[model samples]
Target: MRTSIATVCLSGTLEEKMRACAAAGFDGIEIFEQDLIVSPHSPEEIRGLAAELDLSLDLFQPFRDFEGVTEELLLENLYRAEAKFALMNRLGIDTMLVCSNVATATVDDDDVAASQLRRMGEVAAGYGIRLAYEALAWGKYVNDFEHAQRIVDLADHPNVGTCLDSFHILSRGADPAGIEKIPAEKIFFVQLADAPELSLDVLSWSRHYRVFPGEGAFDLTGFMTHLVRSGYNGPVSLEVFNDVFRQTAEERTAVDAMRSLIWLEERTSVALADHGGAPGNDGGFPAYPMELATLPAVAQPTGFNFAEVKAGDSGAVEELLFQLGLHCEGRHRTKPVQLWSAGGARVIINQQQARGLAPAVSALGLDVQDPLAAASRAVQLKAQPVSRRSQADEAVLQAVSAPDSTEIFLCEATGDGTVAWAEEFGSDGVVEGEPLITHIDHINLSQPWQHFDEAVLFYESTLSLVPRASQEVPSPMGLVRSQVMCSSDGAVRLALNIAPMGLEQPHGGADYPQHVAFACRDVVALARQARQRGLDFLPVPANYYEDLQARFRLGDDMLDVLQSLNLLYDRDEDGEFLHFYTATVGNVFFEVVERRARYDGYGAPNAPVRLASQYQRARSGRRDG
Candidate 1:
């Protein structure tokens, strides 16, 4: 859909930004004026480079505060704009983004603004350039897009039109339905950005906290739907001003920007299809001038098949699993891996490639309706495909690498909940016991600071998982930003956490802890059995139990059992959640949870206590060592 990005959205030199954009398959780029002013290459040289890279220099921006001024300032602004127009001609760019007068606007009269804009338009037309006038959210008098459009109409110049920016419109809570009323031809350019809902000033929010579409709280799908309905066929470009994006690698940020656009396009198409753009006909909607490509549609994963942990020495992990009531169902015939199961929950212990690395979650196996199609969609979204070694008799699972370098294996879902690959783990027979754990409830993965947002977009776009609003949980290290991504159903929950600042290593390879939680029918019973088996439970402080009693007013018997078992308890309007954690084995740990009467939360209210306990345990361990 003619994707484009602004040079201001990425890190590195202008040349590096252009190269990264081209490599990421953007059709064009809007050159931010500051990037040009700082470039060693002249405008002509930059134009040549864009041609050599087969990239279009779509627009030069941003000419600001040009209208709504006095006669003397108007003449001075015109002189300044004329110089930019000549430069645009040299750079082979036909359009310039003129932001609404945020500063130096002595006159707030519409006629004065329109007259000044018309005069500037005449100067731009002389150089064969168009002006895409945009409203700034913090503009002095021209903050609203409708206000800017009215001025554009009054100007009555062919070279002047409106540049609709999603951030400007949506951030101000302006209704985008007005866009359809404006003539499509007058919609000269469009810039897209998504941001979290914040209570801060609009300028501060737009300048620093803008995130890629699907990674933030904005209703961009609705925004894009309205834009598409408006029939504006201009390049849908991203113009994000994020502190994080500006510091990340240009290549990585460019790819992330392109992925966001691709996801936005797919989502917009689906929204349009839902709103009367059905198959076999355009279904009462006007044909879109810009074609939006749909990806291979995939359903959300049904459930987690297995969670794989890699450890150099698997003894501690093996013993911990045994204490938790999971038995070694079988060992891989030709690999240094073993499969442990308790009912439908499975954990794979793989030591084949662990080397001397600490224990960590290396891969996740998800049950999907169509593994091949799911893998195909993930690969199309720029996920690197992972090819695992398998013999002819072994099942060949479709796999891809997540942004955090975790392997995601898309396994075929079975009606009977049996995996064919499990057959490869040949052994005598299933262990005999009343299964304590029923299945994998949820998994928590730690993400690097830089890749946290990228990982969110990756899972949302590639796996069709929807992200819940993020929350910050206090830990001994710092505040941990945690967001949950899950299927529409209660199944398949993934909790992604931005590790507390100092705990993570570079490139997300920190020894930051992660855990796999298993669902049990009765967590109290499970905790009792685990204690009998000598499991080292992560101790809950006495103060936590006192607070729990004060909050819930539970009876003495229930509270005593919970405190004795070191179990954490929480209750919502829906039901109760009781869970307990195992002591950490390297960077990995386990959790057993009992969800009562449709309780769907992850016990988020108790996260701070758990984090404090784990931190205390680690510190004590260090002291003992």
Candidate 2:
């Protein structure tokens, strides 16, 4: 899990990016082709600067669209690759990021792609250079790790190994388990990045929206774990190409990039230990006990306040809450909001005007020490939850609504006093629905482009989230970008996705929703509570449920109940995601998930079904839509 960042991850000239990487504590740099060929900075100058700054040129990327071509073109591409290799040697760099063909490729001809790639490797071998061949998600052919690995295996050139990019591995929905079986030596490099969890044609979004790891919806930790298990001991570098990253100050971007690497290092170390140790190896790399690396980062959340419900007819919703043992707490002085209390949590129901449809979460009333103080800090860092939010009649506070808004209102509300309001919202008998949604786990948001990095910094510098380093999503999900801004201690998390510029335009899946995932204590118990709450949900089908039971050996009738509720579930060797849905509130609907031990995925396996369901609902014009 040692860290390195591609120079392209920074915003400025090659020199500026290098200086930023050095200042941010990165160990190595991946030089982008355009940065090198177009810049006034020569290979010798880059080499000199790297030496002075104590940085390694981890990789030289990307020899593009090289495979699946005629010999004439292959020869031309070979010469170009050789020239770059020679330059890398001058700069003391050893690796190259060779991409599978894009324009000159045809899936019908694997031989051409492989032959061209093999020839390029042969040329690089003479330069003593290692080429990390990779599948571009949208490549005419060779668009995934497994496919690229086949090409690499066919080539059988030690200098030609594949680059395992988390973004590429994940966006294509490649089976991560294969990573553990890849010959460690064939794994030439690792490109790490994260993105907002979205269902789209993968190509357009990856390039423009990628953000640091733990920031987006991708399961980067799982990818890295599989990498280590496969015996990969190479430099795990960052290769992000985001428009937002390009606009920021070089130093800040570098610091942000280093933070992502450090964060990934810590996570990978733990994930490896969690999965059985490397058959003989430490089965892990970054877990190498270091002093500064282990220091604490984010703050632990002080728990939550309630699950909200606002209804045009409060009668049904109110009955549901009461049936679930939730009781009334107090009323909002300035708004038409009322509070419900249950077991140390408070859920607010804003019926003030009954603006739209049924009850959805109105606001998240978090307990902070000083509202004014936090507000001041937020201003300094330019990180407020969202601006121009719906405000109450009172001038003292504000929380405007957005497409997907999670209003964090800090006030004299909590007073840092003991957490109040338990009996009301707590389980009266077995409160409601599937109980998949326990406490507020994390919030999912879609940010406009060019501002994603700015939002990350806001959360990192103000709300106590250390933004993961930036990385790009390979094609199909091409160019989509995102990052996770989690609470210091990992209690509270927010995932921000970089929506394509024309988000309002038509694309396949459901439009990005501002949805929140709830984490439960005992999913079984919560499911029972949901049963009592009159929730309208469909259980997982018998086939899926039966398959889950057989695969995980889960005891009890939990599977049957989940099936009966029309819920969705998939369990991995690590953890499982039990998902269920209800009516939509405009474009987004609530997703209640039950995560077993070590489950950190944002429910990707279950995405197709969810998206299809939303798409169907949109066609019918459902409620709150």
Candidate 3:
């Protein structure tokens, strides 16, 4: 039940990464060896920081290539591990990642590997440290969980156990069922990642393209479910390697990664219901709500909201959503992301990007309660203001691309503050920061072409957000440069960025407006249910994941499940994200995002590829006409 993730799972300097991890609400962190060695802060200082953050140093990882080495090298390795243990003791870290003979193994035999490993485990045990043996996908030996488990078993050392990495497990076609056979106690660590369904070299792909749990094409839910079913409840950590993620800002990356965790929780809940795995001790995560199943046919107004606009001209943007039934509410105290109300539902308008904020869309968010305080804190913390707009009063200021041209309105919700959007909106019925919007689940914004940079800065500077490790889509229907933004606190989100121009093909009645995304409890079940109601649902091609399976040779069950729903998939070391886009509404389209533990992003990697495929699918036959 204790959840954990590796600090290295995130991308940044060790301190930044760990802080981001803690801020993202992780209970534990796995320290990479190099991170500690290269840090300006001492082990004691690092330990103190973690304690201050109430975060546990779950593991001091990656004592690499330890197993199957010569006696001289083994002794040297032990000496190295002993030193790390001393630091771990300083930092209060408990476990270390021990790769079994990845690069420097002299012997290939199991006896040699297990014997060498066992001896090292005792050394670690002496330091009161635990060793988690892991298999690299391209390891010299012991390259899978089953094989690593064999080494742990043959070693006969309680101090040593197998670490289950979803990437290595699924990449080499390792079985999840085997995890159940092993004792949960012996399964020392669980690392997760997701990837596109391809037959590329493992190292290159894992290093460059690995995504979070919900953004790839792997069955992390099944793997974890088996672990859960076996009562192996432990820290299920994410270990990812995507270049884009590394290059992004620390806070933005952390939020997106954490959002994937939320998405994964939802998927695991649904998967357990269908596959009969162990039920979560925590509350269940229902899938994103795509239809009006539980949503009131007519939403009631909560009165806590704001709106935004970067108009090229007069009220063009305002007139659009207003026609969609949103009413002009009052102005925000501070910041630019505007607020609009309809019944109880909230709608935000963004026009900051309309003039030149190409990549970013400054949309309105529901009340954050202390808009003034949040804005002041952002400014004190060096969160920049929107260059174009200005504010007069002490009204709760939502951020207008505070960091990246991504605007946000902080309504008085939970945090202690003097400012609240309620007073400004003049609504008596609405409570402050009342999770009025049950779950954003998802949102899509259209971006202009080759202008992901502007979008990136807009969201980052404007909203203090960052792009998740996925893809920058270049579909003909706008440039689709998505940068998902989330609160410093964890929250669900989906920013479907689009390029300015339309796609090459005809976009006839496309309305590329901002829209909310939702996840349903069950897509197939809901699909059937909606069929009777005359809602037009898009059909998925059976052959999509077919190429995925044939190409990657990953597990089959998850592939079939995704295909049945016409779900789009992409993978990296992080995890797999399953996605499906709906046909256009006005100029808007929505994506139903379902993330497995291996995935977190709303299928960013698959966005461009899927868009390309959709274009091919939609416009393929038009040439003949």
lDDT of 1 by residue, 1-625 (tens): 7889999999999999999999999999999999999999999999999999999999999999889888888889999999999999999999999999887988889998998899999999999999999999999999999999999999999999999998999998999889888999999999989998889999999999998887777889898888787777889999999999999899989988888898888888888888877222465665777788888999999999999999999888999999999989778998989999998999999998788877889999999999989998887787889998888888899999998899999999996989899988877476776887999999999988888999999999999898988999998778999999999996899999986666543213455788999999889988999999999998899999999999999999999999999999999899999999998887888999999997999999899998888777766653110
Comparing 1 and 3 on lDDT, the stronger one: 1
Would you list the rank order by lDDT, best first? 1, 2, 3
Provide the TM-score for each candidate, comma-separated: 0.96, 0.52, 0.56
Tens digit per residue, CA lDDT, model 2, 1-625: 4568987777889998888888777788888888887789778898999999998888988888788777777788788788788888898888988887778654457666666677777888888999888888887767888988888888877788888888888888888999877888898899988877776677766777788875577888788767766767778888887777888788867766665666565566556556654223453533322222332332333444444555455555454444344566656544566665444445566676675454444465444555566555444332334443244433354222222344655443453445433322233244443432335676666665644654564455444565654444322232445577666556557777775444323232344545555565555555566676766542233565566677777765866666666667776778877666655553334556678777766665555455455545555554443
Off by over 4 Å in 2: 106-108, 278-299, 303-625
For residues 51-124, could you state the per-residue lDDT of candidate 3 as single tens digits? 98888888877888787888898889888888887777888877888876667887888988888888888888
Residue 492 error, candidate 2, Å? 8.7
Instruction: Tell me the deviation in Å of residue 51 in model 2.
Output: 1.1
lDDT of candidates 1 onward, in order = 0.90, 0.64, 0.60
Judged by whole-model lDDT over C-alpha atoms, candidate 2 comes out at 0.64
In terms of TM-score, which candidate is stronger, 2 or 3? 3
The count of backbone overlaps in candidate 1 is 0
Off by over 4 Å in 3: 276-444, 447-625
